[model samples]
Target: MTTRQDGERRRGRRPGGTDTKAALLAAAREVFIEQGYDGATVRAIARRAGVDAAMVNHWFGGKEALFAQAVLQLPFNPQELIANLLEGDPDSVGERIVRTFLTTWDAQDGGVFAALIRSVASHDQVANALRDFFIKNVFSQLASVVSVDGRAELRANLVASQMIGLGMVRYVAEFEPLARTDIDTLVKAIGPTLQRYLNGPID
Candidate 1:
């Protein structure tokens, strides 16, 4: 029933309007899970949301910021995570990674990551979205930092296993030993194993 003129008038009247932002967020989640971070384009997300591609920039700044808000719901931007991890010496990357991750989660006060884990536990779609986010954002970034001969995918998976396990135990279940332990102790205990996964020779 709507004509082209009506559509043009609506588009021009509310560029990146409130409703458009919500639609973009929902569409980006589906597209990100379907195509992943590296494959999902801003244009595709905008098209899915039925908005102009420039609306993405106007509403969320860019794909990375949009993704951070749409998926993680954390207080910080995920795109900066890799740059933060790679700031110091390469030899201590594992230590830095563990420390940074724990610090970030703890600071959230069971807000972002906890909700994500709960959603992932309850729904397969949410789980797939979370998996894609981790694989594309966290695992791939860390794997890229290591130049070892091992399969980066394998290495990334191993790292994900350790970190994700630590999160569930330390944050969700609140295991006494790990939950009570100081951050330094955790870094010392878990960092070496992650370091080996990153740079050590695998058999």
Candidate 2:
């Protein structure tokens, strides 16, 4: 192909060229933050990235997946945690789960996770991604390991609440008591609630 054709293809206009996945992700992040998930359309993101809408779909399944990659900025691929949760013992699942999550966030390069929490409160798409990540990636994986009669969904939600609350005080609101606190201290304070959510009776 000619240089121009090659360049066009690389920009996601034709077949057999470099993927514009990273560019679309960066654009999606900006658009989502500025316009929010509900307001940010595929066309808008594409326009920001200077690529075609088809490229968004080609690179990411849809806005939902794109939102997952762009907004959350999780330190590790969630699937790995999901797999570990599925393989672990059920009784102590909550503590393990909490520790795993904390370890992941604590290791991030700062602000990425905080940014995600801030976006979720204001952006519908980002909120949806957060919810879906918990359901599909976190809770569902844990469900495979432990069966709690009829409270699986509720259990998942409870765990999310705990995590979100921790995130808010530590990252979003930056509450002095929680923000400045060490991870071990925070873990000791919150681990019991998480333990209950995982294994205690759900009334």
Candidate 3:
């Protein structure tokens, strides 16, 4: 009975105890930011978290997942995107979606997102992970709500390109005009294009 109880306890929480996953993620975020993606490593993150390297894999699947969770910290979970997309009127989905995304980016601490963009540029795995997160979590969820023809994959990629460019100029590069502009102003300018991608005819 004691042995069984011990097993249950181990399964109940990480070996490092409660909040281990959170600690690891936080450590990973800091390391990724300081080192950039290529410079950051699972062993380094684990060391910062004060846990074995194996713990990272145990908790997050691998370095890529850790990077996604740490750097992205997306506004909503992938599932939530689907739920929101389903809630609003289908016709205005594009506007709502664009506004939603802009709102999220606006709310974050600039440094966190800045690190993510830097990492994406330098590391292929990080770039792929970023792509997967958008497709599986954000775009796929949105696609489930508004049935568009042609593989949902294509539509998702189109939307991603628009958002990625917006991120680059507005957040990463801090380009003039876009960087200084208000969220509402930017949203108005870009929302229509995003809407078209989501719902408008593709020719």
Candidate 4:
């Protein structure tokens, strides 16, 4: 049953499923942007992509992984970052965090992170998705090792705040001194603040 519209025949999956992954990624990005991470279901993404729901799992593992690959496009993997950060001394985790994060972003030197921040800032849905993604992926990992007296959620948010601030000034806004400073300088200046946010007693 082929329907002809605009003098073109609609088609189904190709023999080899050449575009399956690409289709999923494209559909996931749109669905995520419109419906947000929570609102966008794997079924919905698959439906929109013209593939079976199970195909999402087969190709991308699941929704969260799909979202990370499709929308976030982060240069480094969150799990890998956690593993590397944990390899160092527990007390120096804060410094490791700053250095690793800055190094990753700096080496990439691409506008992907900046664009992501801009997207979150401009759209409510995207902002919500980003927050959820961060809490689930980034902050949760940090909170695992960073022991706060209480208000762990607040502590996570505070750590996020410091990282976001650094990103904004150094990468997005290109603020002087901070932007021009080397990675070590940044690690020195910002490391202790993040350390405190991660483990210090809240007053």
Task: Score candidate 1 by lDDT.
Answer: 0.75
Per-residue alpha-carbon lDDT of candidate 2 for residues 61-152, written as tens digits (9 for 90 to 100):
89888888887753467788668755656666666776777777777644666667666777676687777767776787767644477888
lDDT per residue for candidate 3 within 67-90, as digits (tens), equals 777777644464665576558677
Which parts of model 1 are misplaced by more than 4 Å? 1-73
Give lDDT: candidate 1, residue 142: 77
Please provide TM-scores, in order, for all candidate models, with all chains considered together.
0.64, 0.73, 0.80, 0.68
Best by TM-score: 3
CA lDDT for candidate 2 = 0.71
Candidate 1's residue-wise lDDT over 1-203, tens digit each? 33556546656655677988987898887776566666679977877776788999998889767766776655566669767887778889889888988888888665445555665666565567667877778776776677567577787788778988999888888889888788999999999878878877656
The C-alpha stretches of model 4 lying farther than 4 A from their native spots are 1-68
Per-residue accuracy of model 4 over 69-130 as CA lDDT, tens digit each: 87676556776787779676777777888998888888855365665676677667667777
Error of 1 at 145 (Å): 2.3
Candidate with more favorable, higher lDDT: 3 or 4: 4
After superposition of all CA atoms, the RMSD between model 3 and the true structure is: 6.8
Better of 3 and 4 by TM-score: 3
